[model samples]
Target chain A: MFSELLGIAIIFGATVLLAIPLGLYLATVYRGDKSWSDFLAPLERLLFRAGGIDARRGMSWQQHLMALLTINLVWFLFAMLILCTQGVLPLNPDANPSMSPDLAFNTAISFLVNCNLQHYSGESGLSYLSQVVVIMFLQFVSAATGMAACVVVFNALKEGTNEKLGNFYDYFVKSLTRVLLPIALLVALVLVFQGTPMTFAGKQPLITLQGDTTAVSRGPVAAMVAIKELGTNGGGFFGANSAHPLENPTYLTNMVENFALVLIPIAMVFALGFYLKRRRLSYMVFGVMTAGFLLLLAPTVYYEMQGNPAIAQMGTDMQLGAMEGKEIRLGAAASAYWGITNTIISCGSVNSMHDSHMPISGMSEMLGMMTNAFYGGVGVGFLNFFVFVIIAVFISGLMVGRTPELLGKKIEAREMKIAIIVALLHPLMILGGTAMAAHLYVSNPTEYAGWLANPGYHGFSEMLYEYTSAAANNGSGFEGLGDNTPFWNISTGVVLLLSRFLPVIGPVAIAGLLARKKYTPESAGTLRVDTATFGLMVFFVIWIIAALAFFPALALGPLAEHFSLY
Target chain B: MKNNFASAFRLTLALLVLCCGVYPALVWGAALLAPGQGQGVQVSHKGRLVGFENVGQKFDWPEYFNSRPSAVGYAADGSGGSNKGPSNPEYLAEVNTHVAAFRQQNPSVKPGQVPVEMVTASGSGLDPHLSPAGAYAQVERVARLRGLPAERVRALVDARVQQPIFVLLGPSKVNVLQLNLALDSLSGR
Candidate 1:
């Protein structure tokens, strides 16, 4: 327990230690690079004149986000092209060819949107040409696009005229060349140390198996996993995914991979809170997310630690954690840890199966998915969390007869409506999807229910949770449900599309509105969002929203699983 | 708050550049100057350095201890499944394939038993290191077929297993590729 406590403290300490430096750097970049601007001035003017847009004026937040969305849309089309024609491309080892449209769209929207929810394994489905030209390259720039959005918004929020949100292209390029590419390379090297396969070779030596010598598949996976995780993109290079020894070579490597998955998402809030000069504000976001994150983590760890008693009946002696749907070396601690971290960060990679977790553990993972999407990542989570804070603060402000303000800007009617919609989207998706799954389709029953593994209500709950995870861009699965089927694929795809765009619109709207507002300097009576008080307030708001929407769904699934197993 | 917030964000962005860009350039340069490896980006073989042997796809020939339980990684380019469980219908079927294969390779061996790790794949399906027990279990069969003594084979295993930082962090294991290479020389294959 002391060690665990110490581990938690160390984790938090590292987060803050790294965040302070990182946050300060982000602050500087957002203030704009005058030297670079001067150098690019002529080109910017030329391009703007050619493109028939005003070069001198700053883009409104709406206009800026629109540009981002438009680029993303185009990127989606480009990614789809690679996926569709992958089979015909050279460097095709498998002779495997062209992706199905649905799969192609899911993957394209995934990477282009930076969600990277993969339905296809890389080594087989994609040719080397497809892998390099499409996935790897998209990874570099798509990552930049997301980071640039936040940087632009951060600048707009701070800049005096409420005019210059900064140039989109410059920020995107810098984010790619300066941030994503370099970090990805370093991480890739570290991953190689952790035993990720780094090769363009045909395959490793063949071991004779089943009277046949099977040639193994090999490609540039180490490089990809490095960027995929760092960029918070969750697509796996192969089907066995991260648990593959090559993907995660050792337990130490596993820990590092998990660390890679989350380091940025947690760090970003400090980036936001600190750069805003409300150290307390960043602290508050930090505290709230930590509280929310840890709440989710504890139960997952406990349930995973509790493990499967049925396995215990065999006298095999499984550990006490949520052993179901998890790796033995990793155990429940690590699985639960990944579950919580992935959902919080809005990164969808899974090291363990979630569908098999004990009921309580499952809910906690769900709650992590629900994370009000707080400063969530490059695009979605943070904006969602900010909106939640807006409404929570706004509601409280109204009740107390004080104006609701977040980060020195008034949280007015439009912002509250947007937050409400964004906050409400998942519950609607979860409930609607669950209801449809239960009322309409019945999956071939899987055999492992202590409760969650069984049929009927628990089964319905599983469907709901799966949709919730998918919709949330939180890819941790219940594993009890077979979702590779068309119903799930289609439904998840639909939910994914809606979920992807909805939260985005809300944030862009909020940024636009906020961009239009003149600065309201802090006064003594104004609500302070930086202190522990604000932390608790934000924490309360997050809890209330999660409880209201998810409690029943969680109860039917993980809650029931817990009692039946116990 | 305004001023402070901007400063923190700037600091973060700068550090990101430093960590992501500058640090990597330094590492890449170091690799170039270093005595061995990864300088050209591929982990290659001794002679042609034709391709990187370091990662991906296990070559499952009879003599070598297979590296990982790959999904679609081998020649098929389509992922596969062992599909065995404590009670799977295909469980016995898959195990029999492993059992039969091992038995064929070691005609002197008994028929029914095989080590579990040789059959089961890790979650990632791309694991390169064999578990210690998995490697040790293969020693008797490998030694007998290659006409090498058990002690020598054990020595090879010991040589392949990576070293530890402390008692706990890393596990000792045989590198499947290196072990197989040594086995080939001994067998004159």
Candidate 2:
């Protein structure tokens, strides 16, 4: 037990320690200041020159959105074309069939938006050509897209008002060359050394020690797995995801992959501090996020370590804790830690099955996605948190009988509308989509009997979890959901598109509007957002809006299951 | 709009080559230095191909320490868990069935002495290792079937027990396949 607790502490502590230096480096890269990574500059220049992009030009927030959306549309179309015809494409040693149109639509949008909510499994559903050219390609650019959008907000948050944020293309290109690619290379090589496959060979048939014939699936896994964690794109090369032996290999690789999962999201918080030169504000934000993270993490670890009460009733020794749907190498503690970390950051890769977790632990995983802002997905996590900060600032300002201003810009009614919509949109999409699915399921249980793996309360969790994972752009699921049908493919596809973009647009718009307003420097009367009191306000605002909104639904699912179990 | 589209189109093409083409090729080249050259580490027996070192295979005979229950029956081409919710009556019944079968196989072990991992399905359906308790629970059955002394078999299981990195990082487990192979040599099977 001591070792298990120490294991989680060491992984998280290592991540934060690594993130500080990475955060400073990210600030340097985004600011275009000269640093050691300048060696990659010539490569960036070549990319810009070949594409005919003007890397020096500045962009308004509107222009940034346009560039981001247009390029993303290009990717969506490219992904669709390959996915629908992958059977005929080259590099398909496994000869996996092409996706049906609806699956393709879900997959294309899922990867393009960085959600990676795969309706289809790897190894058999996609050819190698699509895996690299479409899936991995989208993972790289989608993450860079989020980072670029975040840099736009960072540029806007400076003390003086300005229309021209940094050029979107410049930030976007540098995000790939400077930040993501180098780290991906280093991590990929480490994974390869630890026995994660990077070959393009077909599955190798083998005889087991028991003399049964079986074939092990082999692929170029290390390259994709590295970026899948680094980019917070949790799509897996194999159906079992990181839980698969070849995909994860051992405990050492488990620690490495878990480190890659949250490294950038935490680093971005510190990057905000470095970029704005507001270290105290960064500390306050980090404190709140860490507090929420520990709250979710602690209960999950406790319940998972306490073992399943149902199994205990059967007179079995559960000293290993809830070992069902968990790797023995990772054990219970690290698996629970990975589950919460992945959900909190929208990484969504699993080292253990969340569906098999204790009811309270399942609730914690759902809460992580429902809140969607504790060290969020790559660059977008900060954007979601920024929305809450705005709402908190407005409420605090009203209470103090003064107009709300954040970083010297007044927050008017216009900004509040956007923030509230973005906040409300999360629950609206999740609950709304879940309600629609439940209505269909309850209305015709026999017809859609295959849609759920467990009946009653646990069944309802399957549907709710799918939509919650979709709406938060978190891709992990209760794998028992049986969610490959057209209904799931199309519905979650729509949710993924809306949930990913609108929140991004909402925050960028608010920041842009505030950037244009006249500057009001900090005064003694100014609400101190950097203080501990204000941090508590933001924390409450998040729980009230993000957590409380889903309380009734959670009651119907994991909470009800918990009551029945004990 | 036209200029933006053209720039976006060209940039997408360029990035595809750099990311999908160059990045993977570089990793594939460097992986040549790794064991098995990034083609998955394989284990062999008597100079014949057996299995990948880290993937679990089914071992149900009484002479071997049985692997954990698997949802996909240890299919390596694809993998997943049983994904059974803890409170589901049907899932609980299934666990009860596994518990009964385990007791039938090993009559010497008491009802509550069975390790939970022996009956529960693993996440990947390809979990390579078993908790030390899980392996030790089956020591009596395997030793009786192979006609070896229980002490020798217990020592073999002990030798195969892998501690967590530095004994303080993760779970201590014994790889099931390796342990069984060691059993085969011990009994000169």
Candidate 3:
């Protein structure tokens, strides 16, 4: 128990310690300031020239949005094409078949939106070529896309009067080359050293001691695992995700991967501090996010360590904790911590199956996705949390009978409208899609019989978790549910696209609109968001909104499961 | 708009080359310097490849250390958990049956002493290792079955205990496959 607690403490300590310097470095990289990676400037410039891109040309928020959407559309089409035609593509030593049109649509949109909610397993479902050219390609670009969007908002915040934000292409390219690439390279090497396979070799035919011949699929896993965690994109190289031995391998890799998952998201918050030159405000944001994260982590870890009371009643010992749906090598504490980090950062990689967790642990996982703003995904984590900040500032401003202004810019109706749409869109899509699934299940039980793997309350969680994962742009699943069906494919795909883009589009648009407003200097009357009081207020606002939005849906699912367990 | 689209497409092509082709190739090159050169380290017995050191295998014999229960029968092709929630009655029944089987195998040991990992299926049904306590609980059973002294078997379990990486990640565990192989040597089999 002491070691488990110590491990959790080390992981958190390492994340914060590494992220501070990384945040400052990323801020410098985005601003095109003189930095250690200046040597790569020549190559960046050449690529810009080759693509007919002028690095000096800034874009309005509309232009930035168009460029982001256009590039995304192109990538979407590319992914869909590759996925639908993977059967004929080279590197398919296993001769895996192409995906159906619906599955392809889900997969393409899923990856493009940075969700990576795979309806298909990488080892058997996707060919090796598709794994590299389609899946891994999307991992980098999708992550880069989010980082680019956030940097645009950072530019808006930094120079409040600027008519144009920085170039999206520049940010995208630099994010890949300067930030993600270096980190991925180092981490991938470490993973390979620790035993994660980097081979393109086909499945190895092995004879088990039981005399049955088993084929173990191997791939360029180390590379995928590296970016998957570094970018907070939790798509795995195998069906079992990081739980697969070849994907995670050892406890060292597990800790390293967990740290990598949260590093960029936390750093982005600190990057906000460095860019805005408001270190105190960034710390305040970090404090609230950390508080929410710890609150979720505490119960899940304690409950998981306590094991299941129901299992104990059946004469099984509770010693060694809840090993159901968890890697014993990771133990309960790391698994619970992984659950929190994965959900909080929108990194959906699982060392343990969230489906088998104690009911309240499941609720914490859902809450992490529902809130979707505690040190969010790569660049977009802060952007999503920034929405809550806007609401808190507005609500508190109205309560105190003062105009709601952020960093001197007034939070007008337009900004509020966009923020509300972005914030509420998460629950709307999650609950709406879940409701649709339930209706389908009820109306046509036979056709949708295999849709849910488990029946009753846990079955409802599978469906709810799927939509919540998609709507949050989080790709983790309960996994017990048979979710690769056409209905799930199309519905969750739509939710993935909507949930991913609107949060980004809404936040960036608000930032753009605010940047254009005349800067009002700070005064005694201004509500300082940098203070601890305002941070606590923001925390309450996040909790209140999340609880109200998700409590009923949760009540029917995990909450009911919690009571039933007793 | 056309120019922007063209630029975006070109950049995508470039990035695909960098991320997919060059990046993976670079890592693949670096992996050649690592042990096993990206292929997993295989555990061999008398010049015959037994299994990958990291991967879990089936060990159902009473004389050998048993691996954690598997959902997919320890099939590496499809690794996963039972995905059963704690409240699910059917899952509880399955666990009860496992407990009954465990009790039947080792009647001398108390029911409460059986570790959770020993009965519950791992997330990766192919878990190759067991917690030190899990292995120690079964030490007397293996000792009696193999006609070895209980002290010797306990010493073997202690010897097989592997520390968590840097003692800051995961828990102390014993590789079931490795320990069983050592047991085979100890028994002169």
Name the best candidate (by TM-score): 2
Where model 1 places Cα greater than 4 Å from the true spot, the runs are A1-16, A33-56, A159-164, A192-195, A201-205, A209-212, A251-256, A302-307, A317-335, A355-360, A372-375, A443-462, A476-486, A518-520, B1-121, B126-189
Query: Judged by lDDT, which candidate is best?
Result: 2
Better of 2 and 3 by lDDT: 2
Ranking the candidates on lDDT from highest down gives: 2, 3, 1
* Predicted complex 1: CAPRI docking category: incorrect
The weakest ten consecutive residues by lDDT in model 2 chain B span B106-115
Q: What is the TM-score of each candidate against the true structure?
A: 0.77, 0.99, 0.98
TM-score of chain B of each: 0.60, 0.97, 0.94
Candidate 2: which stretches are off by over 4 Å?
none
The two-chain DockQ for each candidate, comma-separated, is: 0.11, 0.85, 0.72
Candidate 3 chain A weakest ten by summed lDDT:
A207-216
Cα misplacement distance, residue A476 of candidate 2 (Å): 0.4
lDDT tens string, model 3, A1-566? 77877888898999999999999999899887899899998888877877788877889999999999988988999999999999998999888999999999999998888887988877779998988988888888899999999999888877455779988999999999898989999999889999888887887777754345777778889999999999888998888899888899888898899999899999999999998899998999999999999999999999999999878876766766788988767889999999989998888999998889998998899899999889989888888898999999999999999999998889999999998888778878988999999998989889888877677888899999999999888899998889898889999999998888889899999989998998888999998999999999999988988657889989999899888877
lDDT of 1 by residue, B2-49 (tens): 432343234333433443345434444444443223322233333423
TM-score, candidate number 2: 0.99
Give candidate 3's TM-score. 0.98
If you assessed candidate 2 against the hidden native complex, which CAPRI class would it receive?
Answer: high
lDDT of 2 by residue, A294-392 (tens): 999999999999999888778688888998899898999999999999999988999899899999999999999999999999999999999999999
